[model samples]
Target chain A: MGNFLLVTIQVDLYDRLALNLEADLVQMVNKTGAKGVLIDISAVSIVDSFMGRIIGNIASMSKILDAETVVVGMQPAVAITLIELGLPLKGVQTALNVERGMDLLKTMIDESPIEDEQEYPEDDPFAQ
Target chain B: MILSLSKDNIEVVREQDVVLLRNRVKEVAVKIKMGLLNQTKLITAASELVRNMLRYGNGGTCLIEVVSRGRDNGVRLTFSDQGPGIADIGQAMRDGFSTGKSLGLGLPGSKRLVNEFDIKSKVGEGTTVMILKWANG
Candidate 1:
């Protein structure tokens, strides 16, 4: 809530809803300038390849916007299904639950290197 | 060696039908006492295939059946679409090969989630896919 945005998916999302969430979540990240985003899907019972791609897309988009994403509370069955679906959710970080996910997001945000602009000045020979 | 205990048909005509199909599959899975993991797998596979029917097939019909072989029980689903049939089913079954804006895991991925899978299609005709999941598998 401080520098992070938290979203909990409590329903079995349909295709259209999942797509809308992907769009809205990315927009929210841009609008709020949140450092980290947590998506809690514990209540979600299934993660088809489509949903899997949406999660991956969200994480990648958030990364491009300078925000880290952590997907949390995935059911064990859903995890197994995703792997079998050949969607390993690459590039997306996961946590056991929301609390751990928040901690992971904090660590990710804290450990990330500062912007290069602040570390290098125009007058510096290496600033190119 | 499989006997059909009960059968029903679901018409997949719109986006909402996909959701209805999944719920019906879930109901059948639970009726047969399918394990949670297996139920989830069955429902997910149903979701993928039904969406394929709606997207590529321009909607279709799904047949739900409860089947049994010896002491084993399972749910069998048949999705038939009148849309343009696949030109190359072999290519379609390969992972990451989609003609649509998707991850391309619908065919092959659904195959992995169930116990048995079969597909039939003819270019310009239509496509039909059948899948079965053993309750205990």
Candidate 2:
């Protein structure tokens, strides 16, 4: 929980709101320096292709900032709609619920191999 | 033998109208005793098309109707817009084809959610999209 950011989408999000959330979530990741992000969408009933793109974008953006994102609690209906919409949510991790999402995120972060000390010499400016 | 039960009209003139349209679609789907998965498909398809109307067509009119063919009942939606019409209907229906900043899934994706999908567009006049989803089918 210390290095994780949690976001729960409780309402059906309009286009503008969904876009804004994508921007804000990425900003939050940068600000908090969180290692992982968990987005709960169990309450959201619809996931159009646009919304699907936003979720995918969030995952890609967070990964760029060295943060892993796990979207959790998707309704079964929503999942079917997304697939029918031709958005399989590739490259994005998903979980059945928040608890599982958190555990998955933790495992992802923990399982990442530590960088070898020799790879980044102390004199390398990028290492800092 | 498709018989129309009842119908309503909604104007898509703004972003909120799309949201309102989604809710209205759900209401109609429920009134027809549509299943949960069918309702979700209806609402989601309505949301995608209505938003397309707002974005490309500068808003339009949507006619929502309940229809029955034999014993099977379904919801039908028709969206009409008098905006800059699509130049190529064939290309437009293809997935991943967009003139806007979107994923280009609205038209094709909406088609997949409904039982029937039809589109008619004239270059200078306008574009119309109609879709139907049966309650049990």
Candidate 3:
């Protein structure tokens, strides 16, 4: 199994399904030892606050497990709709397409500094 | 003259019904020859409001209609729920304000994706959100 999980949301997902997908993705990331997660949403035309939050949650959850996430292939209209909705998707990395997303993942994984310091707490040992 | 393609309301009582509502909205948008972008926006809005109905309104019904006024064709959606009505419609419409644990973009985001948006809620009664997206408008 590759160290990357690629998910292409092919439909306009309902609320429950999106939430399920987020759960599944996080579990999958842990099971597969995934170093990167790339979600392709070029086909997705719109995302509300709920959808936006799920997407953001996926990235955040994956990152917590030392995996980098990249969302790619956002349609122009979708981007505009998200912007107007005031959801900039802060802290989530985005790319133009799957191809570039893969490259970004490669770059991110290679240079990732989280793995080094994450396991070793920077706090003073006397505090414990 | 715009022939009546379809118009109806489906009860959204469960999770499966939310999916059904979105598909129904997509179907009506398709029948009206709505552009791909508009169709997506319509379906997205439908998904948002339908979920809102289920999560906040204790389940309800969504009215999906294909409307035409002269040369302009449109898809209209109306969601009504008999749940705890919003006490402050203005606060609910504001971005990033949520009573629940969400990004709180459901109402305002749905409003931005369509050509027309209207909301009416009476505390203790219920809430109704109506939207219209005209093709090529």
**DockQ, all candidates in order:** 0.76, 0.69, 0.47
lDDT of each: 0.92, 0.91, 0.85
Poorly placed runs, candidate 3 (over 4 Å): A43-46, A114-128, B1-6
DockQ of 3: 0.47
**Candidate 1 Cα deviation (angstroms), residue B125:** 1.3
lDDT of 3 by residue, A20-98 (tens): 9999999999999999999999887668778898999999999999899999999987787677667899989999999
Each model's iRMS: 0.9, 0.9, 2.2
Instruction: Report the interface RMSD that candidate 2 achieves against the true structure, in angstroms.
Output: 0.9
Give the true-contact fraction for every prediction, in order. Answer: 0.82, 0.70, 0.50
Descending-DockQ candidate ranking: 1, 2, 3
Candidate 1's DockQ is 0.76
Candidates by lDDT, descending order: 1, 2, 3
TM-score of each: 0.94, 0.93, 0.86
Error of 1 at A104 (Å): 0.4
Clashing pairs in 2: none
Lowest lDDT block of 10, candidate 1 chain B: B14-23
